[model samples]
Target chain A: MYKIKVHVYLKENILDPQGKAVTNALHQLGFNEVQTVRVGKYFQLFTDNVDDIESRIKSMCQKLLVNEVIEDVDFTIENAA
Target chain B: MYKIKVHVYLKENILDPQGKAVTNALHQLGFNEVQTVRVGKYFQLFTDNVDDIESRIKSMCQKLLVNEVIEDVDFTIENAA
Candidate 1:
């Protein structure tokens, strides 16, 4: 099997309310160090197919894993078993 | 400023319904290669404090950013203007 790690995040132009909320909370806690925060999704996929795995995962991302119009995804695959 | 990237995921023994659902959907879509899927959260924290940033972020993760009982968090810090 292969272990795939994927990171998905909003495009640079999009507004992320959850991130803003977290940032504000940090500031309220007197953590003046915080400048900004952005929240997103991470996914791990276990697969049996090993051949051309990167392309396969990319295809999966395109079809169901991400909204290409608003989010960008990056992934890495590792051999598990 | 510094950019802190965090990855938060469920503990090994925890059940991930969202991951399972995605796996089932992929199989139904004829992608039998997929064996399992796990979903998690990712965060990017922009901070102004660069000195001893790692410990500070780890403290944040332990306090409000994660449920220590159910999830594990890992983070990296980068220098960003």
Candidate 2:
């Protein structure tokens, strides 16, 4: 099996209320060092092969993974035994 | 203020139990077409300026925004009036 990673975030000019909330919570918990905070998405995927990983996953991203106008994503691949 | 976006996801080959769970939930909700599913983080940030957006936000990602070892992420930027 293979593994795929996906991340999603909003554009720089966009505002993130959720991120701010989390940052506040984390700070309250004692991690006050988090001066600036933004929240995003994280995922790990398992697949059969890499032959079609990009085309398939990228398509999935556009359709179901991302909000193109206001978000960005970076993906990684690996062989999982 | 300027806005910043951040995303974080697990690297390919990594296993995401949470993603699987969400996929299952979505499937149960009726989106069965989702053959493969992974979940990640998404964030939007507001900043005072862009001059230091990259250095500051990128550093935030490494220190707090991302897991580095098992996740991938992409972010966008825009000017907010």
Query: Residue B10 CA error for candidate 1 (Å)?
Result: 0.4
Residues B39-62, model 2: lDDT tens digits: 777666655556655665666666
What local distance difference test score does each model get?
Answer: 0.87, 0.67
For each candidate, give its TM-score against the true structure. Answer: 0.93, 0.55
Against the true structure, whose lDDT is highest? 1
For candidate 1, please provide the TM-score of chain A on its own: 0.88
Each prediction's RMSD over C-alphas, in Å, is: 1.4, 7.3
lDDT of 1 by residue, A12-36 (tens): 8999999999988887876778888
| Structural RMSD, model 2 | 7.3
**Interface RMSD of the predictions, in order shown?**
1.1, 5.6
Provide a comma-separated list of chain B TM-scores, one per candidate.
Answer: 0.89, 0.83
User: What would the per-residue lDDT of candidate 2 be over residues A1-81, giving only the tens digit for each residue?
Assistant: 777767676776898888677788656654444455667776666666566567766776776668899988888877767
